[model samples]
Target: MGSLRLTFACGDYDRTRALHEGTVRPDGIELISLRLPVEETFFRMMRHHEFEVAELSLSSYVKSLDQDPSPFVALPVYPSRQFRHGGIFVNAAAGIEEPADLRGRVVGTPEWQLTAGVWIRGILADRHGVPVDSVEYRTGGQETPGRIEKAAVDLGEQIRIAPIPEDATLSEMLADGRIDALQSPRVPSTFRPGGGVRRLFADPVAAEKEYFTATGIFPIMHVVVVRRDVYERYPWVAQTLTKALHLAKREAMANLYDSSALRFSLPWLIPGLEEARALMGEDFWSYGLEANRNALATFLRYHHEQGLSRRQYAPEELFAPEATEAFVI
Candidate 1:
C-alpha cells in the first residue's frame, strides 16, 4: 500500500518542529507540512477545509462542534498552549487598575472568540468577578485597518459586542484611548513610546504564575484537527497522529532540559525548563485527553458561558474515541 499521503498545517514551533522537519513521522502518513501563521491556518482550515489536518483555534474548534456535521474532529494533541495573563492591555489613564475596573469599560479584541481573548475574559470573569456581560466589547484588527471574524460567535443576550468602525483598528483605538482595554495575543502597537497603553497586570509573568498556582489551568490555545472526510476514511490516523505529536513533544522537552548547551537563543533555557516543571507538573506541556482535563474543561466552560459554543462540551467529547483510550501493559 502507498504511504497514506496527507497535508499537515500548523505553526512553526519547537514542539511541532520535529514532525515538520521529518525527525518524527506519523505512523504511515506522508505529510506535506504547511507551516503558516496560526491565524491564517485557522481561518483557511475552518472556512474552507483547505488542509487535511490543521492546528485549530481551541475556541473555534469548540464552537465548530455545534455545527451540523462539523467539518473537522480534533485530537488531544494541542500544538499551542498559552497563559493569557499577559494578553490583557489597558489604557494607563482608563482607571482600569484591576479586572473589576473593566466592568463599565470598552474593551477591544482582535476577535471576541480568539482563544487568547476567550481565556483572558474567562479569567477576568471567573477569578476576578468581572462579569463577561458587564463590559462593552469592540472587535477589529489590531494594527491593520480591516478584519473579519473567522468563526461565528454567539456572545449571548447579556453581553454587548460590536465591530469597530471599518476605517479604524483596535491598535488605533487603544493608542488614542478610545478603547479602555484590549485583550489579544499581540501587544497593541500603541504601547510604545509615550503611548498610554499598559498591561492590566503590570507584572504579567507574576500574575500568570499566581493564576496557574491558584487555578491549575495553563490555558490551551490550539489543538490538532483532521477534516471529517480524512478522519472517517482513516480512523487510524487519529491515534497515529496523536502518538507522533506526543513523541515530538517528548523530544522537545528532553532537549529543553538538556543543560549541556543552549539549544535555543535564550539564556537560562534549562533553568527556565526546570522552573516550568516546578510550577506546572514535570510534563508542563502535556498532550492527550486525561492529562489536560482541567484546562480543557475550564476553556469549554468559558466557550459556553461566552456563547461561543451552543453546548458545554466535555473534554472526552472533543477527541476521537480511539484517541481517548489506549491499551496498557
Candidate 2:
C-alpha cells in the first residue's frame, strides 16, 4: 500500500521544525504539517476535530478522557514544556508579596482548563501552601473580551470560579486591582513599563530553578494527539509518528552544541545551554512515557485536585499503547 497522507497541526517550534520542513519523514506516512498559532490550532482541533494530528493542551486532553467517546488519543510526544513560576503576576499594591498571600484573593485566569493555569495552581497549592479552593477564581479573556472555557468542566461546590464581566478582561481587572492576581501563559498588556503589574515572583528565573530543584518537575503544557477516528483507522500511525517526532527533537537538541556557530539568537546561548544540561542532564526535553512519567503523574494529580479531571489518571493511560513502547533490537 502507498504511504498514508495525514495532516498534523502544531506550533512552529525548533524541535518540530524538521517535521515541518520535510527533513524527517515518518515511515509509511506523508506528513502535511500546518504551522499555526497554538490558540488557533487548539480551537479548531478541540471544537471541530480539524486535524488528523495536532498539539493539544495537556489539561484539556485529560478532561476529554472523561467524555463518552473521547475525542482524541495522544502520543507520548510533548511539544511544549515550561516552568510556570514566571506566569503568575500580581497587583503590586494588592499586599500579595508571596504565593501564600494569594489566599482569600480574587485571581483571574484566561480559563480554568488552560494547561498553564493548571500547572500554576497546582504548584501554588503543593509548594506554597495555597490550596486550590482557597482563592476565588475569575475567568475571562486576558486582553480581549468575551472569552469562555472551551472544555465543559463541572467543579461542583468545592471550587469557586466565575466569569468576569462581559465587557471586562483579566488584564484590566488585574491592572486596576479588581483582581488581586493573574495567572496566564501570555503576559498581560499592562505588565510592561510600569503599567501597574508585576510578576508575583520578583526574580522568576531564580524561583523557577528553585521550584525545579524541589519538585523535579518541568511542567508539560502540550501533547501531540491523534483524532480518535484516525487512530482507530490506522493503529500503527501512532508509533510511526512518535518515532519521527523523537528523531526531530534529537536533531534540534544536537544542533545547540555546535560551538562554531550559534543556533539561536541569544548572546550567551552556549552558557545557557550548558547550564540547562548541568541542571537537568542531557535529554532534558525528552519524549516518550518513561522519561516523563513522574511529571505526567504530577500533572494528572493536579488536574484531579483542581477539579478538571474526574479522577486521577496514570500517566500510562494518556497515550496509545503503540506510542508508549518501542521495539528492542
Candidate 3:
C-alpha cells in the first residue's frame, strides 16, 4: 500500500521543525503539517478533532482521558515546554507584592484549568502557601472581550469561577482594577507602556531560574497526540511517530549547541546556552515519559488538585504503552 496521508497541526518549534520541513518522516506516513498558533491548533483539535494528529494541551488531554473513550492518545514528544513563573500578571496598584497576597483576591484567567494556570496555581499554593480555592477565579479573553472556556471543566464547590461580562476582557479588568491579577501564557496587550499593568515578578528570568533551582521542573505546555481511532486502526503509527519525533528533537538539540555559529536570534547565545546546561545539566529537555516522570507527575497532581482531572494519572497512563519505553544506543 502507499503511504498513509495524515493532517498534523502544531506550533512551529525547533524540535518539530524537521517534521514540518520533511527532513524526518514517520514510517509509511506523510504529514501535512498545519503550522498555526498553538491556541488555534488546540481549540480546533480538542473541540473538533480537526486533524489526525496534533499537539495537545496536557490539562485538556487529561480531561479527555476521563471520558469512556478518550478522544486522543499521546506520544512523549513535548513540542512546547515553558517555565510559567513569569506568566502571572497583576495590576501595578493591586498591592500584590507576592503570591501570598493573592489569597482573598480575584484572579482572571483565559481558562481556569489552563496548563500555565495549573502550574502557577500549584506553585502559589504548594510553594507559597496560597490555597487554590482561597481566591475567586474569573474567565475571559486576555486581549479581546468575552472569551469562554473551550472544554468542560467542573472543579466543583470549593472554588468559585465566573465568566467575564460581555463588555470587558480580562486584560481590561486588570487594567481597570476590576480584577487584581491575570494569569495567562501570553502577555495581555493592555500591559504595554502606560497600560497600568506589570508582571508580578519584576525580573521574571531571575525568578524562573530560582524556581527551576528549587523544583527541578521545566513545565511542559504541550504533547503530541493522535486521534484514538487513528491509533486503533494503524497501531504502528504511534511508535513510528514517537521514533521520528525523537530523531527530530535530537537534531534540533544538536544544532542549538554549535558554538562556532549562532543558531538562534539572540546575542551571547552560547553563554546563555552554557548557563542553561550548567544549571539544568544534560538532557535538560528530554523526551519520553520516564525522563519526565517528575515533571509529568507534578503537572498531573496540579491537574487533579485543581479539579481539572477527575483523578490524578500516572505518567504511564497518559501515553501509549510503546511511547513510555524505547531503546537508546
Candidate 4:
C-alpha cells in the first residue's frame, strides 16, 4: 500500500519539532507536519480541508466548529498547565496589590477573548467581585473579533476592551510600565524579563486547580483532530497515530534532558536539539487521552453555557471510536 498522508499543526515550533522528531510510526503513514501560528492553522484548516489531522487550541476548535461544523472531527489530546489570565502585574513602582487596584489601570493582552483573558475575567468577576464591564482592556492588535465573538457567545463579556500599540510585546510593556498588567500564559523564570514587574494576585496553577475542583472541567489549550473521512478510509491510521503520540508523550515525560528516542525521531526539525531540550522542562508539555477529554468536556460546557453552540456533544463525536477508551475525562 502507498503511504497515507497525515497532516498536523501545532502552535509552538519547538513542540511541533519534538513531535516530528519522535517515534512516528511509518507503517503505511506519511506524516506532514506544519508549524504555524494559531490563526493561520485555523484558517488553513477551514479553507483547504486537506489535512487528515490537526492540533488546535481548544478555544479555536470551538470557534471553528461554530463557523463550520461539518468538515472535521475534534478529539481531546492533552491537558496543558492551567494558565492564569486575570491576574494583575504591575511595576514595583506602581504599588497595585489587588484585583480592585486594576481599576483605571491599563492592561495588555494578546487578544480580548483569548482563553486566558476570558478565564481571568471570569475569575475577577466571580472571585474578586469585579464587574466584568468595568475594567480597561488593551490589545496589541492581535484580537480576532470573529473568533472572539464566537468565544464570547460562549464565554460572555469577560474582557473590558481597549487598544494598545501594534508592536508592543508583553515583556516590553510590563517593563516600561506602558501597561499596568498583562494576561498571558504562565511564564517560567527563564521567560520572565529581569526586574520591575511583580505578580500581585491570581496564580494560574492555583486558579486551574480551583476551577477544576469546583467545576470538574479542565480547560483544553490544545487538541488533535482528524477528518472523519480519513478515519473511515484508514481505521488503523488513527490507532497507529494515537499509539505513536502516546509513546512520544511517555518518552517526553520520562526524560526532558536526554532521550535517545527523540534524537532519532526527527533530526531535520531539531538541528541542534537545543530548543527541544529547553521545552522538555517538566512544566512545558503534557499529553494523554483522558486528560484531554476532561478538558474538552469542560470547554464544551463553557461553550454551551456561553451560547457559542446550541448543543453539547460528547467527546467521542470528535475522535475515532476505538480511541474513546483512552480518553478519561
Which candidate comes out best when scored by TM-score? 2
Which runs of model 4 end up more than 4 angstroms from their true locations?
11-19, 35-50, 79-82, 85-88, 91-95, 103-106, 123-131, 141-179, 186-196, 202-219, 228-236, 257-294, 303-320, 326-329
Model 1 lDDT per residue over 1-329, tens place: 98999999999988989999999998899999999998899889888999999999998998888888988888888788888888888888888888889998999999877989888888988889888888999999899878989987755576888999999999889878899999999987788645588888878889999998998888899989999999999999988888888888889888877778888999988777788988998988888777789999998998888888888998888998777663121
Candidate 1 residue 322 Cα shift, in angstroms, is 1.4
Error of 4 at 10 (Å): 3.1
Give lDDT for model 1.
0.87
* Worst 10 contiguous positions by lDDT, candidate 4: 142-151
lDDT of 4 by residue, 48-67 (tens): 76577876556556555655
lDDT of 3 by residue, 69-184 (tens): 99899998899889887889999899999888899999999998688899899988988888999999899888888677769787779789999898888988899999999989
Instruction: Point out where model 2 deviates above 4 Å.
Output: 193-195, 327-329
User: Model 4 misses residue 287 by how many Å?
Assistant: 5.1
For lDDT, the strongest prediction is 2
Please list the C-alpha lDDT of all candidates, in the order they appear. 0.87, 0.91, 0.88, 0.57
The TM-score measured for candidate 2 stands at 0.97
Q: List the residue pairs that clash in candidate 4.
A: 21-265, 21-266, 137-162, 153-306, 154-306, 290-328
Please report, as a residue range, the 10-residue window in candidate 2 with the lowest summed lDDT. Answer: 320-329
